[model samples]
Target: MSLNGPRGSAWAMTERTARDVDRAKHHFSVGPSAMRWDGETLVIDIAEVSSPLPYKVRGTIRVRPEMIGSTAFSLDPEGRHRWHPVAPRAHVEVSMTDPGLRWSGAGYFDSNFGDEALEDGFNDWHWSRAHLRNDVAVLYEGKRRDGTPFDLALRLDRMGNWHDIEQPAPVRLPRSAWMIERLTRADRGFIPRVAKTWVDAPFYARSKLSTRLFGENVEAVHESLSLNRFRSTIVQGMLPFRMPRAIWR
Candidate 1:
């Protein structure tokens, strides 16, 4: 679990064995935290201690989907990886007891699954999602390990209809604080600017971009992931500090 905000930021990824995990049709639990779907909404209960700081991070997040998506797209030619936009549009409410904060806003939910490690299939990837006047736009592109490239431009309407649109021209953004490359897509002649950076790490970066997409101006949530960086020995050695392992209960 991770929370990045003005009040403070907390990240906790406790490694738990299979014995400490439980799951059902609509509920899943690992260690002290759990997520459950209650017919209309998805509720997440988080109870964790931040790594390297030991700060309490207890909160409840509710995600109410405005429209549910039903299609999953393949990310690789061999069908080894897939991406699904479960909730293309949603309303999210955040209530944190540890920090005594509450807020609500537009949100999105998605899932990704693969048969092999991400590094074995890709070099890096850039993705962004934005809300248009009556639809949502998602852009995805990446370079494969074998030097192949793939891209997808999709738009979803309020009624959960999906449409494939022409991909806009690529726009380069400033590198992250860690020197990670950042990129996005925008209409011709328009440049995309980084409005805010939420998570900036050696292997990944998440930020907000102000750009024009498909004739609409929007503030999009953007992310870049470098599998090569994540596979480095230095980053692997530093993972324990950010993601501590917990003893089996």
Candidate 2:
């Protein structure tokens, strides 16, 4: 989960085992983090935290789908790797009691799952989502472990229709403070600039950018991930500090 605004930006992530996961239709709870569907509202309760956050975070973020288009994109011909964006344009209203955080804005949700590990199938990937008027556009580009490249551009409309737009030209943004390269696709006339860096790690980076897409200036949530670096022993050694798991009897 992430909180981004004028003041600052903060992000939290947790990794849990299958044993801790409770799953059902429109209902998911893993340890202290849970999300449930209440009619048209999606409630998220996040208590699992690692460092710097003084209080546990719990919030009800309403998700109203403006577009219903969705598909599971197979990253590998063997169907071992796939991605799905269930909600492309979701109207989100966020409210947190502790520490008093409240905001209402647009949001996006997607799921990526695969039988094989990420490094086993991907070298790296760059993903970004831009909210357009009455629609949402998502761009995905990456290279497979075999050095083959993949790209997709999808736009979902309020009428539940999907359009495959022409892939925009690639634009290289400035490197992160952590020295990781960042790139995103945009119109040839537009330049994407990272406005804020929420998390800049050895192998992963998440940032917010202001870019022009589909003829509109939009603020987008962008992420760059390097599975090759993540597989390194040095990066693996740093995981525990950000995502601390506990043992239970």
Candidate 3:
């Protein structure tokens, strides 16, 4: 779990064994946090202590899907990886006690499934999502381990319909503070700018982008992942400091 805001920042990634995990038709849990789907909304309960800081992070996030997605897109040619935008358009309600914050706004929920390790599948990837007037535009592009490239552009409407669209030209954004390469897509002749960077690590970067998508000016949440850097020994050695492991008794 991670929270970044003006109040403060907190991060907790506790690794646990299989004995600490629970799953059912509509619920999944690990350690002290869990996510359950009610009839209309997905509720997430978080109880965690930040790593390296030990600050409490307790919150409830409710995501109400305006429309549920029905399809999953393959990220690799051999069907080794797949991406599903479960709730491309949604309303989010956040209430946090440890930070004493409350807010609501447009939100999105998605999941990725893979048959093998991520580094074995691809080198890196860039993804972004923008909420248009009555639709959501998502762009995904990446390079495979075999030196092949794949990309997807889709527009999901408020009525649970998906339409394939032409991908926009790639735009190079300023590198992150960690010097990680960042990229996003925007309409022709329009340049995208990074409004805020949320997470900047050795192997990953997440930012808020001001860009034009589908001919509309919008602010998009963008992320870039470098599997090459992630599989390096230096980054591997640094993981223990950020993600503490514990056996749930």
TM-score of each: 0.96, 0.89, 0.96
Best-to-worst ranking by lDDT: 1, 3, 2
1 or 3: which has the higher lDDT?
Answer: 1
Q: Cα miss at 112, model 3 (Å)? A: 1.0
- The local distance difference test score of each candidate is 0.91, 0.80, 0.90
Instruction: TM-score for candidate 3, please give it.
Output: 0.96
| lDDT of model 1 at position 60 | 98
Clashing pairs for predicted structure model 1, backbone only:
none
Q: How many angstroms is residue 89 displaced in model 3 relative to the true structure, after the best TM-score fit?
A: 1.0
RMSD of 3: 1.4
Q: Model 1 off-target regions past 4 Å?
A: 246-249
Predicted structure 1: clash tally? 0
Better of 1 and 2 by TM-score: 1
Clashes of each: 0, 0, 0
- Report the CA-based lDDT of candidate 3 relative to the real structure: 0.90
Q: Write one digit per residue (lDDT tens) for candidate 1, span 43-155.
A: 99999887778888899999999988889999999999899999989999999998678899999999999899899999999999998989899999999998999898999
Worst 10 residues of 1 by lDDT: 240-249
